[model samples]
Target chain A: MSDTSKKEFKRSFSGYVEICENMPTGMITVRGDLNSRKLKSAFSKVVGATLPKERKVTLAENSIAWMSPDELLIICGYDNVSDLMKKLQKELDDQHHMLVNVSDARAVFEVSGAAMVEIIAKLAPVNVKTLEIGEIRRTHFSQVAAAFWLTSEQRMKLICFSSVADYMFDLLKTSAVVNSKVGEF
Target chain B: MLIFTCPYCGIEADETELTPGGEAHLKRFGPGSSDEEFEGYLFNRENPKGVHFERWRHVYGCGKWFHAARCTLTLEVFGTYSAQTFEPPEEIKERIRAKRPGWKWRNFS
Candidate 1:
């Protein structure tokens, strides 16, 4: 087990986009056959949200993001993770499923500004500017695996493993520096 | 940069985000097999110049293992398929054959 409290750090940078880290989002990693009705019903009931379609993010009482064909990441209030995990385990006791409290294993960051897309584009090979509201993409952020979703046109949330939080933050900071703008082509 | 769409997640990933797993669809030779068969399975491989099947893991995206049919001569990728399959699907082979007529890669014609 990892000490979730160790090495906790938070920082922010000013640039074309404001890059802030350590926003503290609770994450639950669910693994199972996504097509199973039992899995879907149990998950939606506990998490209070609908299952997201392929490569999508759904926001309701809670937010659920499709991580892969057989995996999902649920984002919710940090304090409710234990309670929800207990309920989910009880609801899916007989099914071939895995529900884990991954809240402590990840780092959440927020980027705000009209030019937020430019900061993301600098590190990832993606066009964040055109990302649909409910769309989420899992891709490499320079050298690390990361996922990001749009909260709105000028705001976004990004998450990656806690182990690489510092690296990801620094990378984002460098990309957001005022002079590094990837202006309109 | 070479790109292969992950068959599982439908994400078109570049070579840098993927981990190549050498050859694909190899038969395992267990303890009862002859030394020649074991040696073939352990070390021998077909270094063909065209229409090769290889395994790759989408380490950066969906994290799924899949197979790709690529042309070594031009770095052209025919397509990617699920790694759960026992052999290359007929459609991919047909596409390869269409581009290179009468292509013979190992046991497949």
Candidate 2:
């Protein structure tokens, strides 16, 4: 066989796997006029309030509703995906609002071990200790912008762009192992 | 570390990506001020312990400035507002009234 016919592409990564036991986390983007009280009211009805203390259904356990003037990015448990979308759509019926379903377009990683904070700090810029309980933030993940929902005392949900999901997953897993010191909190 | 919740991005950014400028949206006095007044306006910093207000730049995110408050001891961030269209939230006003007793927000500009 000629060299041209037997050419091979160099592998950047060692081995590739089709499906990861890793299930994707749910994500949704909501946009509308934030100054309008009625619009906010409608959002409150759909996704509950910006504060969990004022609402019933929690997007994530102990998660806070972080909002801007025109946009709200909501993070909920992966299981309640379909129901939340339907509820949001119904709430904004005939209104000037949009809800884009991005659940499959992002990767979700639940970090909840004792040293989860330390592990995360290695990858992101924000100090885990500075983040209060029930805080939701849309920040960057190693140069890639992401939204984080601090779901519990120990649990944090990270949502990032799907195209880089595999890269992020690999980076996080490796960093966690190196940073997670044995017998240390 | 101070975190500024960006009004545009809705992300609470780190102190690393920000630069704190004492107060937010202050109107500068041109060549029409006294020496003492100018010194106070230009150099003095209100280093309050309980609730100090500071402006920050979201350099990496929106590249806009916003105001944020924090407790020196507890470091609890109560709220954040934008520099251009920042209207202090009512929740904060109520808290200040309750905590500071006789203190009032004196606005000159």
Candidate 3:
């Protein structure tokens, strides 16, 4: 195939990758159901090499369980996605868990810096303060069904369904940007 | 929004995610049991001050149903656990009363 033809095929065939301009976000859903025991073991193994120390785990320096069993719904830096997913896949494969790559099934975004909760509450219904650090919840932002995971007080990660990803990203970014501009003055 | 803790989701959602199944941890009996035995298990509750476990649905979130513990007097929450976690405690388990009782339910399933 010619390079030009290959490029066209690649663009059309890339079904799972979705990008957002305002927040510079991307998303994917990995499907696997693991009970508590299996989840603990799998998470420990997968996160082991990345942090690989008891001290880090105790201090919660890197990763955490943002939700309960059956689904983990991880959050990581956009640049680290390839490396993170590769490591996660290896761990799932080792455990023989049924891992389905649904990366294309959702939209992801990074809402960071201070005042993140105050900003998100304009759309989200639940009280953000009640969500302890390292917890994840499936809730609605505005009318959008979304799953949110907090990596830190200043940073939160959210996933909206793929079909509405564009709408959600645009809505959130537009509001947050407008608010940031207001704060700047 | 009401503060409701989902056992499966492990957090208090906006009451929107949870379908309130009424009081948590009620006990029912099978058909084989005697009328009085069945009644005892069917309807009885202790008005207590300490940990009281109740059931709730994570309908909007995980869709996994579970129970939560709340204090009657203080309203202090103990913890939330899956409905499948263990058998309902003996105290709250089946036996009905002839006097004023709880609400009616068509399907316990």
Candidate 4:
């Protein structure tokens, strides 16, 4: 194949549900005892947002989400990650924690439109309709482990391991097409 | 597909997101324990058709281990609770009793 053909082909669909891959961003996984005041404050200061409550995502100057009781995922500009990690390490030096740069390990997709919730409902077991505006959920999307968060009333972000990016894209595309056809019928 | 409420995240998770960890509250028979105790702990399991307690992990969700009270025959979930305890909480037993009346499992009334 030509180099042009080898280049990553971004897929998107616009219909009752819109699905598209999001631009790359810095992604970091932080694991520690979030109950500790010092750890919480340092994390909030470094990420520019407090660690969100259980099953929620906090969006402020930066986006920090609660992945688990002891884990948080931070998203920010790709350029800011290195310095951010360094600063966080310094701040948390005395504490027991783990910081991992997972920017290249995952793919992110954004889905929107009027039938967005229904489309996601087809793939995941979550009741996306009841998912609060800022809530996030970690679940499987058609057999692939995935997580999603509502970024706006009409938009949500889905993320999964990069190894299955193509599979995730295909599943979302198929679901969108099937849903749009159902609307027509 | 079973739905379980994760105690740590306080969110309902589908069976796909949760990994079943087998029967909960198994007493470990470690060093100095009798061979019979070790064998029972390692191999024997209470496979009840009615009310049963099992371990589940919200691996894809909050990554916490929890306990679920379920009926194996009917596939009806009684309730889910934290995995920290050695036995199902009193409240969960009470709920199961209210639903299954005259149920008997282990020592839980």
- Best candidate according to lDDT: 1
Q: In terms of TM-score, which candidate is stronger, 2 or 3?
A: 3
Better of 1 and 2 by lDDT: 1
TM-score winner, 2 or 4: 4
- Candidate 2 lDDT at B2 equals 60
Clashing residue pairs for model 1: none
Per-residue CA lDDT of model 1 for A68-118, tens digit only, reads 999999898778888988999999999998888888889999899988877
Name the weakest run of 10 consecutive residues (lDDT summed) in model 3 chain A.
A8-17
Model 4 agreement with the true structure over A70-149: per-residue lDDT tens digits = 89889887678888999999999999999999988988899988667776778888876578888888888988989998
Lowest summed-lDDT stretch of 10 residues in model 2 chain A? A10-19
Kindly list the per-residue Cα lDDT of model 2 for residues A1-185, writing each as its tens digit. 23432333211121111112135445676677656666666656766655332111245331324444455566665556678879867877777888877777876656665566665567678656677655555556776766565656666766667787767767666665542454334
Candidate 1 per-residue lDDT, tens place, B1-109, comes to: 6799888887778897799999999999989999999999999988988889899999888999999999998999999999998789999999988999989877887
Q: lDDT by residue for model 2 over B10-109, one digit each (tens)?
A: 6667776666767654556559888877887787666555666667777645456777755555677767776765446677666666665554333411
Candidate 3 per-residue lDDT over residues A78-125, each given as its tens digit: 355566567767756656454434445655666666666765676776
lDDT of 2 at A26: 54
Off by over 4 Å in 1: A1-9, A127-130
- lDDT of model 4 at position A38: 84
Superposed by TM-score, candidate 1 places the C-alpha of residue B84 at a distance from the truth, in angstroms, of 1.2
Residue A97, model 1: Cα distance from true site in angstroms:
1.2
TM-score of chain B of each: 0.96, 0.74, 0.59, 0.94
Identify the leading candidate in terms of TM-score: 1
| Candidate 3, residue B4: lDDT | 59
The C-alpha TM-scores of every prediction are 0.93, 0.52, 0.54, 0.91
